[model samples]
Every structure is written in structure tokens, then in C-alpha cells.
Target: MDVSGTRATDENTRPPAVIKATARQLLVKVGAGGLSPEAVAGDSGLAVAEVEAVFPHRDDLLTALVIDAYNESAAAMERADEAARAAGASAGGRLLAVTRALRKWSFDNSGEFTLIYGSPVPGYHAPQETVPPASRTPAVLAGIVRSALENGELTPPRRAVPGPPLLRPEAVELFGGLPPAPFSDVIERGIVLWSSLIGLLVFQVFSRTHDSVRDESAYFDFAVAVAAEGIGLVVPLDDGAHTT
Candidate 1:
């Protein structure tokens, strides 16, 4: 889609697509603050006026990039989940699958990943419009939780943990309202699962664990399996043992 929210056809989308493609390249070299209509135009071989025609303001271009990154990352997870479902994998298996897919995407597209998940670009506040695409990845996680609950793959904690509701009204509504009883705690666990997934990816992507961790891929599976247990999922680790 173009900045105007209109779906872009082949001919029209080509320019914005080219512009965005070029902008992504620039994001690596110059960082977000360095992005501008003139920079994209120069790198893309288009006139500055043409770049401005699509993205008159720099933030418009940044928003488009942010939206694209979220969508592409979410698409990877969604694809992984679909494949796991087709293979009759359990929800725990699907959780591992999606996180693995996202991990691969983050490594493959570190620049884009960092663009969205890395440090905030100075002076840029994401508009409310970014919310939907931003929600897609976590929504995928929530779907896995819902399926697990329905299929009897996940059990809520037996005892009510003493605390207020983990999710606010809006977040609860967004996930199709709270599940009954302690089952709602499962949703909170799903949230932690999502956060830990991203946190692990960030640590790996930024090379924060390179010194201490050997065989990152194996380590990721182990970590995600551990996280799954927090939500009552029983994913198998690399050694073929389920997380306790």
C-alpha cells in the first residue's frame, strides 16, 4: 500500500517500491535520521521531486518502512505456523516453529529488524496507524495460544496467581476478550512468551551473547522450549526432551 492507504497496483507501486527498496539500503548505511526524500531519490535514480511526490515528509517514508518490516516479519511467522499446522504439529510445536521463523528473519534482515526493534530514531513518534501491522506478529502468537487452549494442549495455572489483570481492557478486547478463569493466565503467559522470543532474538541479533553462547541455533530452540513451558506448552528441546 502507498502512503495514502490506497492499494498500489503494479505500475503505481513500482515507484514507491523502488523508493522503499532504496531507502532500506540507506537505512543500513546512514541510519533512520539520515533518510530523506532527496537521499532516496539520489540512490534510486529518481528525481527528488518524484520521491517527494510519494513521501513529502520524511516521517511518511519512515512509517511506510516500519509497517513493511512488521508485516514481513509477521508473514514469516504466519507461514511457519501454517506449515506446522499442516504437519499436525502441536501448538507447542507451532510456537517453536514461529519463533524459529522470526529468528531467521531477524538474522536475515538485521537492518529492517533493527529499524523497527532497535533504538528509536530521534524525533520520530510512530503514529497510531502503525498499530495494526505491529499487532500482526503478536496476534500470531495469540492464535497459537487460543488453539492450544481449544485443543487441550495448554492448561491454565491451577492456582490464581495474586495480581491484577495482566492485560488492560483494550489488549484483552484485541485478543477476543479474556478467556474464562485461570485460563486468562495463559494469555499472560503467551505475552511473556512473545516478549522472551523477541528478547532472545535481540540478544542474538545484536551479538550480545556471542562470547558466551556457542551454537546459537541449538541454543534458540532450547530457550524457546523453556519459554513454552511457562504457558503450559510441552515443546521438545534439541535433545528430544520436553521442557519441564
Candidate 2:
């Protein structure tokens, strides 16, 4: 039946996946500088030639990892938003759900999170192909804003931020233009919100606020709620606690 040859073919097809998995492990242990075809081969029990055959170049492997991490993180947020919508949560609540999903993903895959969001990989300039996946996470935020505006759930902020079009032309085109008047600034605020969310996770994942923040989960909710206000979304703060 030539079972051994068939098995060999199957194994050959899986080297990229195996090599990437091994690379991620090494990434956590020794940082991006430690990544190389030989390192992945040694960890995956594959020949260096096999790893190189799959990745072709070190930058190729790094790009794949970046894209994978971005897509996975975006999927996590998308899933959370879908579930929140199914549950009839408010736009603001969905925002919270997605942000919380990101935090959860960052916690679960800290190494991958750092790979994408932490310091830039030394000398690795990700190609343009990385942009689409990189945009997915922020696109999730933009989608939420668009949905909210459509449903009349999004409010216009009282004060303008002094810039009529804070979103760049490319960003405007990418997001399909800003939400109409009064809400025109929502996307800009959303950009701020997105950056704030990432900054919050970065602080926690990198232990920047360990000494100061008493309760990270609670703090995140508070910070997100505050940020959401700038976007005209009203996220509920801790429901149980009464502040005097």
C-alpha cells in the first residue's frame, strides 16, 4: 500500500507548522535574536534545510509569525463581539467585550503578543503584506464604531478635538470614511481607544504597573470605560462597587 511513502509526504507537508511552533517556543526563551532556521530545526527535530525550505528567509518566518499573531488576536476579538451581539449587549458593552477578549488573548499568548506588539524585531522590516492582518484588530474597533453609529447608539461628543479630520486619508479610506457629522471624530477617538487598550495590555503583560495597580482586571475596566467616553460610547464601570 506504500504507507511509509504516504506518511513521508504527510510529514513533509507539516514542517512549516512544526517549525513555527518550535520557533515561537524559542522566541519566548531567547527573544527574536535567537530565532534562526537552525534553532527552529533543532527544536522541531527537523533538518535545517527543511526549516529553510519552508521559511526561505528569516524575515519570511518573522512575517508569518506577525501575521499569525495579528489574525489570531483579531479572531479572538471578533468572536467576543459576535457573542456579545448574540447576547444583545449594547455597543459599549460589545466594545468592552472585544477589549477584554484582547486582554485575555494577550495573557494567554503573552509571547506571541510581545512578538507583535512589543519592541520591533531587530532588523526585520515587515513587508507590506503584513498590513492587512495588522489592520484586523483595529478594523474590529472601526466596525464596532460603524455599527454603533448606524444603530444611533453612538453619541456625538460635546467638544471637538480641534481637528476636523484627525484620521489620515489612508485611514479614512480604509475605514470607509468617518461616521457622519457630530460623530465624524468617533474614528479618531477610536484610534485613541485602541492605542489605550494596547498600552494597557502592554503595561500588564510587561509588568509595568505591577507595583501601582492593585487590581488589574478592575483597573482595565475602569480605564476602558473612561476611554470609551471619548468615543461617545458609555461603558459601565464596576456595577457592584459604590464610589463616594
Candidate 3:
């Protein structure tokens, strides 16, 4: 009995788990760029044909890993937000909690975080299947912002000199007027707030800030505060006084 043939048969028959396991190991061992059917097969002990049978190409593997990372990140955000609510935090605090949660996940899972948030995987364009999972984390923040706006917790930013428009006319329809046409500026700031979280992580998690940020944790909290305020999560005057 040839063990290699038997193992190959198992890989061929159960390609889904084997391929997923292979992709996960490849992400940890070689990062996204190193993800290929050959590498997956080599590490997974599957035939190259077996790996390709499931993934088809490197992009397929990348999409699987990307979606996994996105889902995990979203779950982390949701869990952190839940903790914030448990502590009787305001909507703004919940937003900050999710941001901090995701940032912490980025530090812990740097490779996967980079796979999702870092850079594009060169020629690989993620298909539409990735959209919903990819949108979950942003939806978390968007929900908070929409709540703040509806509940009158948000302070609409006053742009000076009436600068050029940021979002297209179509974006209004897409947002379903949550910010409303009158407060489109508010939605714009909401987007920047979302990006700021990612930017902060890229800076800290990727070592771009290195010596520039001596206390990254404090800086992150401070930045989260700024971003929270940017989206109109106000710290009550009494609460502020009590903390310091």
C-alpha cells in the first residue's frame, strides 16, 4: 500500500478542507504573494492538480484568504462593540471600541491583516464574492454614524470656503440618504474616520511609525478619540471631567 497515493486520494476527494488548510498555511508561511496552487499543494501534501481543482488559480486562493480575514476582522469588531455596550458606552465609544478591536487584531494577525488591508495582491482582483464580507467592518462603523446622525448625537462639520465635492451624486443614492443630502458633508467625514483607523494601523502595525510613536497604545487611544469626535461621538463634559 503506497501511503503517498492514499494521501493524494484523500486530498483529491476532500479538496475543500485541504485547500483551505493549505491557503491558511501559505498565508502564515509566505504571505499573500507566496500563495499559489503549487505552494499550497506542497505544504498541504495535496497534488498540484488537486489544489488547482479547488482554487483554479492564485487569485482564487487569495480571495478565500481575503474573505476569511475580512469575516474574522468583522467578528472582532462586533465583539469589541458588544463589550463597549456592556460597559454602557455611547455610540461614539462603540465606534472607538470596534476600531481598537480591529487594530489589536491587526497587531496579532499582521500577515492576514496585511492581506486584507495592506496592499493589493498585484494583478489579482477580488471578485464580487468578497464585497459583502469586506463591507462588514465598515458597515459596523456606518451603523454607528447613522445612529449618531439620526439620534442627533453627531455634529455636522462646517467646511470652509465650500470646497469641491468628494462623493459623486450616485453615492447619495447608495447611502439611501442616511446622512441626507443636506448633510452629505457629514458622510464624507464618516468615510475619513473609517480610513483613519486603517491608516493608524498601517502606521503602527507596519512599523512605519517606528520611533515616531513612542507610546503607540496611548497614541492609538488619542487618535481613536479624535476619530470618534470627527464622526460626532461626543464625550460628555461630566464624563470627561471624571476620567481626568
Candidate 4:
């Protein structure tokens, strides 16, 4: 009846579930400073060989966890976006939605978020050698810029700056009334804005500052206002730019 073949097939199919559950357990232990494969295997009542059969290596587990966390966060962000849009939110409103969503994700999934965002996982380098565009904070700023461009918030196109060395046609179209500067300038500003948002979130999540002065929603509003100002969007008065 080829029972051996049937057993092998079943084991192969079941290993993935065992591996995922084992990884989840290990992630929980990671915060307690006990996140070794051996520890996880011992805790899960699985042999080291069985654990490795699923995860292959420690980094593989971490990478899988990171990817899983990212997918969860992204899903939450999409739902937040939908909710904001349904409530007739403007770009500023969407910015708040995404910011709050990210903050909540970090707070709720501290271990997973810390592993991915706070420190690099061993042996598992990002394959692209670049951050995911959607995950990049600059991409969020760029989104605001794009929205502003579409809404006719930026001044009309006219050559204002001094030099004209090289430029992308898309860049030219977006930075209205701005000179033919390098695209790097725009990219740099976006990166700066992105960094600001991330830095604020990290600070708030980690509780680096005193609780009396910490208001995540207010900080988020300020960040959005600053980003909007950088991209020439009409700054909303109620965005908490002047608040702490």
C-alpha cells in the first residue's frame, strides 16, 4: 500500500504548520532574550532537526516573521485608508489614518515590529538591497506631493531657479514653478519628511519622551503639515502644527 510514501507526503504537508506555530512561539520568547532555535524546539516539543526542517535557519524564521508582520501592517493600513476615504477625508485625513494605523501596529505588535524595525535580523538581508517603496516613508510624502499636484495646490510651472543641468520629465511636471533642479533634490526632501514621521513614531512608541508631552495624534498632524508645507500644499490650520 506504500504506507511510507503516504506518511512522507503527510509529514511534508504538516511541517509548515508546525514551523509557523514554532516560529510564533519563538517570537514571543525573543522579548525575554531567549530566542534560539534550540529553545524554540524545546518549548514546542519539536526536535531541532524538525524545526530546522521547517525554518532552515534562524534568519529564515526572522525573515518570515518580518514578512508576516509587514503583511499584517499593510492590511491594517489599507483598512484605515478605506475608512478615512469613506469618511470623506482629504489627503491630510488619509495621512492621519495611515499614521495612526502604523502607531497602533507598533504598539500592539511590539515584538514583531521591534525585530523588523528596531534591529536587523541575522543573515537575512533585504533581497533588493533597498527598502520596499510602499513601506518607505518618503513614498508617503511623495503621495502627498502627488495629491497636491493633482489638486492644483502647487504654484503653476515656471522656470525660477538658476541652473538647468538634467531633469526627468515627470519631475518637471510635478515641481511646478520650480527651476530645472536635479530630481535628487525632490527625493531628498521626501526622504527627510519620511524620516521625520518615522522618527516621531519611533519616539512615541518607545516612550522616549515624557508622557505629559507625548501626543501621537498631535505629532502626526504636525508631521503631515510639515510634509505638506514642504510640497507646497496649503497647510491646514487644524493640523496641530503649532501644538506640542
User: What TM-score fits each model?
Assistant: 0.89, 0.89, 0.81, 0.67
lDDT assessment of candidate 4: 0.57
Displacement of residue 9 (Cα, Å) in model 1 is: 13
lDDT of 1 by residue, 4-107 (tens): 33324466667777888888888888989899998888898999989888888899989998888898899999999999999998888888888888998888
The residue pairs found clashing in candidate 1 are none
Clashing pairs in 2: none
Ranking by lDDT: 1, 2, 3, 4
Pick by lDDT: which candidate is best? 1
* C-alpha root-mean-square deviation, candidate 1: 3.7
Report backbone clashes per prediction. 0, 0, 0, 1
29 Cα displacement, candidate 3 (Å): 3.0
Lowest-lDDT window of 10 residues in candidate 3? Answer: 1-10
**What is the per-residue lDDT of model 2 for residues 38-115, given as tens digits with 9 covering 90 to 100?**
888878799999878778778778878888888889999999999999989888888888888998889888888999
lDDT for each residue of candidate 3 in 1-244, tens digit (9 for 90 to 100): 1011111235375776677766766677877888888888888788999877777878877777778788888999999888877998777777767777888788877888888887787888888888888878877887777777777877765552167657766444444563554465776776788788889889988788768867777677777778777655774322331110
Q: RMSD, each candidate, Å?
A: 3.7, 5.7, 6.5, 7.8
lDDT of 4 by residue, 1-244 (tens): 1001111233464655555555565665565244556876787677889877766666556555656666666667667777876887676666666666777787777776676666565445644423352354334445655565566555432333345425455444444433323322443454455667667767766777446566656755666667655544454546443322
lDDT score, candidate 2 = 0.80
